[model samples]
Target: MATILVDLDGTLLPLDAWNPVFAEICKAIAERAGAPPDEVWRRAREKNLILMRRLDWRAFDWQQLFDAVAEELGAGRAPSVLEVLDKHLPRFRPTDGALEALRELRAMGHRVEIATNGHASYQLPVIRRLGLDEIVDGVRTSDAYRCPKTCPQYFQDADLMVGDNPIFDVYFPKRFGLLAIFYGDWEREAAEHSRRLAISIDAVRPDHVVKNLKELPDAVRRVLALR
Candidate 1:
């Protein structure tokens, strides 16, 4: 059976679910620093972007980012971002048809597993709460592996990698000889999503594209036929 590694955040769940958590982090920082929350959020987001671009994907740490934000704002050890995430996790809902897609893919005889990038402490609990454990064979996170899917070593011996993030989950994994499947339609996506999708499509060229998970099995079969 082909081992199909899947992404969790944008792939299985609404990526916007994280916005509130980050907002809460900024609020906490602002409260401690006696600064405007919007300005604090802007600065923190800028810091996050800088770190994201400079650090190796393996070295990216949320706690470190929070610490940096605190330093930048002179807030001195701001409240835990993990705590905010924990508080908001229950409100994080999976994308439409996501669970059914996993169950159907497994029924089609593929070995489905989660190979996501995020803090495992936060991500694992959300996965469990969403009932991902019932569908996927296993789960792995960047926190545990010390690398995102951008690192070829992130997953071993996978036939395919599927996700919405064009950079980390698709383009990067393609480097390791895994067939890449873009999980969302590019042209129909929002502008930001389309931009990333275009970049990945241009750079790495996915083997298949499925706008919805319901179409995933067919896409996989098509790729398998070529093999």
Candidate 2:
């Protein structure tokens, strides 16, 4: 049996309200700072690009970005990003077929783990709230390890990782010998990120790519075939 790692957010759970909730968070912080909402958002995005380039994916709750924006705006006190996320938590139900697919993978005797860049402070609540805690063998967070998936230790003894992020979940771990299942098509995203981040992302490809979670089990089967 192979050890497998699965991503959260767009992989295990659907992130339907991500944009609107984040926008509202920025607006609230901007209101407190007495700055234009666009200015606050721009600062957050700037900080996001910097963190992403450094492979720091631990702040999925956007606390780091929020703090940076508050500092730049001198907000003194910023609105709680987690509070906003909590209100919209219901919108983050499991992605269609995700639970079933995860069960299938585990039933095959694979050691399945929820490996995410998200901090446990926020991500775990959602996992448990939606009952995913009972489905997987364990959950792993970059915040817990103090490092992202780029670290070799994170993938130690793991045969594969399935996630939606082209860079963090796929490209970064592929070099470490983990087969990959990218949950979506990422050609345009890869090219755009290559230019936007000023990094060479050419020739990055996962062992399998599935646009639907229902296809995930078969994708895993194909990936395991390579082993």
Candidate 3:
């Protein structure tokens, strides 16, 4: 069976699904330090960006962000990363049409797996919470792979890759010779956002472009047919 490697965040799940959970973590950290949660959270986001710049974007570890924010807040007590994540995972749901696509693809005898750039502690739980494990063959993470999806070796066996990230999910996978699908509505991205970025999404082309998860099944089928 051919392997279909799909990105987790922003593909199987919404990108900002962790917002409320991160808020709760920040709130708890602030309470320990007698500081405002919103201010602490804002600073945490800034700290996260700074840290992210120092490492490969795909190798980003949320635990590192949590530790940085906790240290800055002078938190007397902080919940463990796993503790915070356990509560957070419940907030996630599979993206629209993601579940159906996975099921149909697997029923078609394709091997479906998640290839994500994330910390496994939280990422794995989120997959389970979203019921993705029901149809998924397995999952791989940057943490386990020691490299971002930008590296072709991240998935040497993937015949097809799908995700919202044009750079990592679509462009890189195509370089690795996988049939690619650029999912999500890229047109909604602000012009100013592109102007500020070093490289625009338009620069990284995929074999197929899909506007939503609901379009993914057909896109995948069409790509497979051509192969």
- Top candidate on TM-score is 2
* Distance from true location, Cα of 18 in model 2, Å: 2.6
**lDDT of candidates 1 onward, in order:** 0.76, 0.82, 0.76
Q: Per-prediction RMSD in angstroms?
A: 2.9, 1.8, 2.7
Per-residue alpha-carbon lDDT of model 2 for 1-227, expressed as tens digits? 98899999778887664676788878888888888888888888888787767777643548877877787787765667678778877767788898999899889889899998878887887898778999899998888788877789888889999998777788878989889888876786667667765767677788888899999888888889978
Please write out the lDDT profile of model 3 over residues 1-227, one tens digit for every residue.
68999899888888888777777887888888888988777776776555444436533676667667778778854566668767777666778888988888888889999988887877888888888887899998887877778676787888999887766676568777888887865555423334433345566567788877778777888888898
Q: Which stretches of model 3 miss by more than 4 angstroms?
A: 51-59, 76-78, 188-197, 200-202
Off by over 4 Å in 2: 57-61
Compute each candidate's TM-score over C-alphas.
Answer: 0.87, 0.91, 0.84
Q: Candidate 1: lDDT over CA atoms?
A: 0.76
Tell me the deviation in Å of residue 72 in model 2: 1.9
Expressed as tens digits, the lDDT of each residue in 89-182 for candidate 1 is 8898888888888888899898999988776777788898799988899887876766667665687878898888767666677777888788
Instruction: For each of the candidates, give the backbone clash count.
Output: 0, 0, 0
Work out candidate 2's RMSD over C-alphas: 1.8
Better of 1 and 2 by lDDT: 2
